[model samples]
Target: MIASNSRAELMQSGLNLIGQALSIFDSDLRLAVANRQYQAMFGLPDNLCLPGTYFEDTIRHMVLRGEYGPQDDPDEAVRIRVEQARTFQPHYLERQRPDGSWISVEGAPLSQGGWIAVYTDITETKRQETLLRARSEELSEQVLENAERLAAANRELAATITALQETKRVVTETQARTRQVTEMIPAHIAHMDRDYRYVFSNRQMPQVFPGTRPDIVGLTGDQVLGTTTFAVVRPYMDLALAGRHQVFEMTHEESGRRIRIALTPDRAGNGVYILSTDVTAEVEVREALTHASRRELAAKITSGLAHDFGNLLTVILGLQDRLTHAGLPLEAHADVQATLAAARRGVELLERIGQIAAPQGTALAPIRLQDLLRDVVEMAKATVGGSARLTLNADLPKERLMLDPGHVQDSLLNMILNARDAMGPKGGEITLSARAAAPWLELEIADTGPGFSPEALSRATEPFFSTKQGQGSGLGLAMVFDQAKLAGGTLRLSNREDGPGARARLRLPLRPVRPQMVLLAEDDSELRKMLRQMLIRLGHSVIEAASLAEAQGLADLPGLTVILSDLQLGDGLGSELATPSGPPLILMTALPPGDPLRDSATGPVLNKPFDAATLAAAFTQVTHD
Candidate 1:
């Protein structure tokens, strides 16, 4: 609106500067605009010159003042001229006023509305023409009138052409701006005909769905999006063509991305407008929130039961110890020992339940696939006895991945142990395999055993649901599931398609993390020493500090990659330590996972008693740089 007003003012100013008096009227014959010369030429008052003044009134005022010379009936003359103005015809004429002065009036109708008139005082030009005619009698009045009419027509034509050119330029600029805006938008904007053929596109198809062509203006939906993907949206497209709007989300298989598509019927009812955007990250965050809600509910449900169970085991342990000291027959004593052992197992079961119910935090880091597999194999060998054989088949790229190695190793080891037990005394082989599945690092652990029962296959990952009967705590696979979810990965248990064994596949996002130098701070001398050695083993040089003051002193030291401080230092809380302007700071604490001190730390926190691999993973995961 502001721009349009500015243009109108500029056009009016240009017209006012002209020597010819000019006035324009709307289709209703009311004055729309009048230049300074227009009002002055007629000696009109301000009210008569203002926009919306009736043209008929101006003509009547002129006739009453005898500007058009003596008329037989002044009212009749005003009526005739007013009627002619309404016809809006192009006209040129000269009239003599009571003052004996001649003025020429040339009026041309506007394409959109009423006519514009240019009034010029041509008294001098008329005298010149008369003199020329006298000198050459060949130039008659009829010939002079024809020349004046032609000149008027030519001027009107020029004005019309100028208006047309300006209008065209404005329209072109507007279209260019609209196209530029549509092209810059991140989402795909396109139009498709009723036949599902693309008619227009902003060339962003490939960005939303990888592997698809972007120059698809003339392509059919099937040709641009593949048969499978097109099939998913075909029904929606049909609905949109039927004048019904649709909005939904679907997974794009080609790129493994989630996409949101909105289809709206075109106003003409002959096509549909398409808008698609990548919503993969949004979907992931939503799923994570839902999973966290479920975990919180589970924790709430099990807290009271686990607490009561813990007290009962403690009492049982006390009674068993008393019975052991009371001394009965040898057989009775042995029975008492068995009772104590069973009670201890129950206590251990309760602890496992607590761990499962607790919230799990993930610390991801770069891990060499080969090194991880080697560590898992060595760990499994110690637990699997001589009867079982273990093997690793890896076809992974020579790259480091962002992952929580400790959790991954623990989950893998748990699966291996479960496999070992399933195979019984005459254990067979267990195979661990790794491969890159683009966007995901796929790892599988399969064992030679009686395949899972239907009930086991369905309930294995459920908390406290186990098939191992009395010997199992029923928390191994549950913990594994928690770990997988914490790391934004997935764990699946199924029977091997080709054999009599159960296979567990884990898929985690493929992200890389780089190693860095570390600063180890702990008040406990022994723990500090142990952490220092762990950092060195992980190929990171470490600087040791026994207090917050000591850590602050070394915090600014050059080449210090990261700060690994215990939450409770002798001088102050680790969280209170002023972070240096260098590497990231990570806090370590033995505090329960829900402790405020541990939770309130701004940076990453490693729950105390973490292993070398966990520490290394934490370093890589927390320090983004």
Candidate 2:
């Protein structure tokens, strides 16, 4: 009986210990004698296990309110222990607290239909789990961040590589362009070091100087050029190397070529750039132009001398003509006649001199070829009479061409007259014909006379050059040559293939005709009257102005084709007549070359003591149609 009492005390002690442990059981379950641990595990109040309360109703309330197990299956081990009053499989129900603690529940079945779940505090275990989870998340984020950094670095590397390739391409293209520009230059270019060794040269260097080859780029000039070209360039090179730039013109004796070279010092005077240009053609052209200018000046001076001499001879001859005509004894008459003949010869000689110096011919105009030829034939027929037959073969096209009518007539007359002289009283046929060639009007004057010798034909048009002696002035053909030039035409003397005499072929350019008027600006009283008489004889209206002031005062005067002025005038020959009118002028001057009077007149000039025919022809030239 004492042992049975000890067993009952032992059971009571066990119950007391369980009740003090927890409070999670229902009030009804508690009143029905549930363990305190169960009440504490379920978070039940102290009266939750009351006897009148239904166990099923309390458990249903806990289930509905989520106070049951996380796995709320009615048949689960925890649910079976709470409702069926059976032993449950031991499960640690993890419970979390706000202060980071964990409670583990180990449920056990009671005698009544309820569960007695044990409550255990596991704060350190849950804290360890949270730290582990947080550490794991941090590690994953770090891995993502590292990957992003790697991607950014790779992008930057790609950008750097692209930039490097673009720079390479730009450099390559710039080099190519530089090469092209270098080759395009016409001059030779080279670079040299302070040691006088060639570092680089343009493409033209090899061909420019034959003896010096640029293949020896690394060699000094003395070694590569074999001391010839180098000796010429060494002084300049030394100067450049000493920091002074050198520029010079060089003539290559072997090639007879001129070269212009420039040596420019480089930075720090360590090297130099050499540039050379071939100026052989340019130098030659300049020299030729200078020679031409000298010749032209000499020609003008010679012409002026001839003009003054002609004037002196004219005065002498005119006085002799008047004196020789006076009556005298028979013996003296012959001498006087000889003197007159000599004076006449002197006049002809002076005319020849004028022709040689400044040959004046017929005026220029655009005329129908047929009309010009017909006029020549008519005039020739009058001159030749019935001795020689004059015929005109009008085969010319209906086109106008530039010519001087009087000069052309004179040219035709000369040909016909020469033919008549060659006929030697037997007479001969002279045929004047014209035709139109592209860009020219060709006039052919063929005569049936004795053909000329090769010697006579060769110098036919030379000044003071003639076929006839004693009877001709020797300026006829020369006059023809001058007329052809003045009219912008070409003249040729050739033997007639079908005849024995010669053929004079004249071709004038086809151009529009210009209308011209004469402005006779003569200041001398006697000379002005003489010119007016001559010009009137040539069918020109003479508008006579006594002085430069009178000429300028003629406000109603029409524009003129030509101006004829006396250089030594009462008020000075009008420069206005030349500049303002812009007409071709013939100023008659008694002054020589370098004379201030001659220089003052701003127009093409002629010397005084001109013949009547000469003045008439000059007048007609400026007034040509």
Candidate 3:
């Protein structure tokens, strides 16, 4: 009996060890039978007869907390996890064991009614998980903030690009406008390479030289004006190409004008900048004013001298003629002839002096240019002598021009004679040409001889300034200038670009004239007939009247284009015609400059001795205005 009891005790001990081997939460909760671990772990009573401890007080207390019996309550939180039997997902909960140790309940549902649960002390794992989650949240917020900053930067970049584009557009437009303004300056501005090839030019260059075919950009003067112009300027260009600046004057043969040029070394040392200015008008004006004063002074001197000599010559000539007609002695015939010759020569000399001293006024009429040129050329050839070749080339249009014929002839002849004198005894060609020059007519005289030097060319037309010794009165060109001024024309002279020569150009205004009927209302018979004759000569049909009633009655006549009335009328006309039916009116008078009729005349006011061209120009100005 002792041996058997020992055996039973040992067997019991082994079973208890097997049951308590696992953690408390690792026990199987689905089984209804109480294993030794469950009974020992909960301190169950030793003599329990029932398989289910439903009536036990300890069981009741555990059931209230949903953890009672061999199998926990079905609806209890812990038992519910066992009933689900979902093994793929692990579930966990925290608890405090009675032993005062922190415990974690972890379980996975099994295929059976129970779950495999383990009670573990896992406080450290929970703490680490909490730390990792906090760190992740902070990192997520930081990422979101950085993304916002990056997006804002992109927007700023886009706005900056847009602003830059707008600024670029504005800069481009400003540069273009600046270029336009630079080109509009009235100078022959240009650039060129060291070889003298053109690089660029302003618009004024082509405008000044109308027929110039030179490509101002990328062409040498030799290429445009041929080797002639360049050959003449080779030294200056050579010096400029060697990096020296030069200021020089050149007479353009093609335009028959003078231009002053300034050349400077380009920035790269391989080019040049040329600035040329046309000083023709300014130079001409200065010369004109200077010569005009000298001519006036010389005229005063010559007129006084001629008047004194003329009286003496007139008395001598009259006495000589009487003596010759009286039939002096036969031996005195030779003496008589000698005296007559001396008197004739004296008279001719006086006539020459008077021609220079006379201050003649312009008397304009419709003059045929062809006839006028022919007559002037014939007279000039005779005066210039046979040694010098005189050629007159007239390209006159069929239209008749209203001009002062005498003044034009005298001016043209004077120019030819000047050319002749420049040729001297060597005898060069003198060419006088006339042709239609746009709104004007051009009279050009070119002479092939030694051209004027720089100083002489500058002051050629100045009064009392002459290159000739003793023979030159210096009044020929001065008188020509006066005639040009009187005719509303311009004169130009410069050295010929081709070789050595000089050319003089005169541009005269020309306009169209219309023939129509005119009603002349005048109180003076002499003035009426004089104007009537002049009007008839101008191809106008004139209806003359000595009184205002006769003029008003004649206004009914048809096809009248003009009405001429006297300012001081005897028939109560007084200068006002009551706004005549259909024609423009003109008032004629010998009134002073401040006369009311002169200022307030409705149409045009013609002063006494008013030339036809002036009247026509005034009429055109008034009607057009």
Identify the leading candidate in terms of lDDT.
Answer: 1
- Candidate 3 versus the native: TM-score? 0.54
* Candidate 3, residue 259: lDDT: 71
- lDDT, candidate 3, 117-221, per-residue tens: 333343444444455567766677655555566568557645744543443344345435654775788776776666677655654565544456634554677
lDDT score of model 3? 0.65
Q: Which consecutive 10 residues in model 3 have the weakest lDDT in total?
A: 19-28
Measured with C-alpha atoms, the lDDT of residue 374 in candidate 2 is 70
Residues 212-273 of candidate 2 have per-residue lDDT tens digits of 66455456777865677778988998899888989998765344457888999976455888
Candidates by TM-score, descending order: 3, 1, 2
Per-model TM against the reference: 0.49, 0.33, 0.54
Question: What are the lDDT scores of the predictions, listed in order?
Answer: 0.79, 0.63, 0.65
Predicted structure with the largest TM-score when compared to the true one: 3
Q: How many backbone collisions does model 3 have?
A: 2
Q: What is the lDDT of residue 298 in candidate 2?
A: 43
